[model samples]
Target: MKASLLSAAILATAIVSVTACKKDKSTPNYAKADDFMASHAIKEQSFSGNAAAGFTITGKDGTKVTFSPNAFVDGNGNVVSGNVTVTLKEVLSKKDVLFSGVMTESNGQLLESGGEILVKAQKDGADLRINPALQNDGARVEIPKAMNKKDMGLFVQDKRQQGGATGGNQPQQSPYTWNPAPYYPFGNGPNSYSFSLPSFTWVNCDRFYSDPNPKTTITALPAFQDNNQVTDLQVMLVFKNITTVITLPYDFTVQKFQSYQNSLPIGLQADLIIIGKDSDGYIQFGTQPITISANMHIDAPIHKATQAEVDAFLATI
Candidate 1:
């Protein structure tokens, strides 16, 4: 009887010890980690989050077609939630449209979900179409033709004429003679004018040319530094009378936001540059990166350019 009682006591203690150990063990929260991984993986695939989100579709001719989020449909005929932007080379007079958007499951299975679609002929041009099975084929809708050279040239000339005047009217004979001292961002005095220095230059070939073998060039400028970090830089370029190349000078490094979202082992990088001359003269302009965080939106350096100054600079090119 004593042996039996001792054995029971020993078994009860063992059960309690096992329960305590289990309580001490940390339960793995796979959900949170999975969520982070998923978000990061999709970051690179996300659109630039610009007002426009779509691909440009170019045809054999120079035409292109642009499609918005409203142009797709899922297998069940449900409209997709996300926006899709497409640019086509030229408008099609008549053609069949077949496209699809699908979501892949964790198990490597594809499921057709919500999407938008159109199927009709209007006086404007071709009809819009969507299909579930089409996703397997990897085909996209067609695009419209790009603007002709004459039209593009006219547009550029109009921009130059709108500016106050050209170098012909200026007293200075050199284009670089525009008082570089006053243009520096940290000039002293109440009436001092300052502007950010150009960061890069992009050159692109004119699309109007018959030859499609246009080459582009991009030149990168020194990065502006502040508090040990790159502060501001401007990229400028001209596009005119060239063939097919488009150049952009930019640090295409994977953005921090993208890195966090995509969970990429390493980020991506690219740059663009273009240069051209219009009927008025050479045209130069490029985009600059602007960071707006929760604490600050407009950095002091970016705000250095007054509206009048920007307009004047735009006019000169």
Candidate 2:
């Protein structure tokens, strides 16, 4: 009888110990709330100076203008520069796609805004949570309030064009007086005309062209010419349809040129290659070369003849 009583007492003690340990291991509701508050705490992030200038765009004949800004508030309540691109997938269906603007720091790091901001915690390491709401046009757009980053959308304004002024500028007339000069060096003849080539300020050789459509106002650099001193030259061409800029690099070969052409659409192909000399005295390629395709709708004076024509022209140079 005494052995039975002792065994019962031992079992009761074990049960109590297990219960206490379980209670100690569980997280309390209050502690969870405190953790959440600590992680989302943000300081002053404001835009006290002039807001960045808005962009202007003209729509198609029957289309309307639409614009929006991607915004985000930092820990100090400061607004960072970023893009908010709104793609009009379908107007009739009211379907649209919105992408947050990505911002790069001076250190070359990239950050994305909008939705949930990634947050850091003392115990949890890194986490994501919804950001706070932003005021826009007398309404609020709810955003995740985490420490990561946030992006907001801005309102757009539009105006209609009228009268002869239209919304665009008028064409300007050339100031040079007409003079007949020899075109070919066949001595002086009445039919000979000395045409003045357009002049352009040489920006950075690596600068990309910025145009969605072809224009007589802008012309890409010329192609590379091979000489006996240089064995080979390679050029790289990058083209974007949305921006409509064709960037050409100085160093590219026939194979690289073919690769670039293959990557583009059937109608959007590069027209020229730009080349220069490297530090080793060998002819190097340009950093950015404009892509000119023959399929463009704009009737720009710039022309990219066939490969045979290009070779013939290079031979002359």
Q: How many collisions per candidate?
A: 68, 34
Give the per-residue lDDT of model 2 (tens digit) for 10-67.
9999999999999998842221222322342322121111112322222221111211
Candidate-wise lDDT, in order:
0.24, 0.24
Give the range where candidate 1 is weakest over 10 consecutive residues by summed lDDT: 97-106
lDDT accuracy of residue 194 in candidate 2: 15
Which portions of model 1 miss their true places by more than 4 Å?
1-72, 78-218, 223-234, 242-247, 250-303, 315-317
TM-score, candidate 1, is 0.22
Q: With candidate 2 superimposed using the best TM-score fit, by how many Å does residue 175's alpha carbon deviate from the native?
A: 46
Compared with the true structure, what per-residue lDDT tens digits does model 1 show for residues 1-317?
99999999999999999999998885532222223223323111111111123333433442222334333444455433343432321111111101011111111111111111221211113222333333322222221222222211100001122212221221111111111122222212232111221111111111122322322212244322222222222222222222111111242452111111111111111222211222222222233432212221111122222234434433432
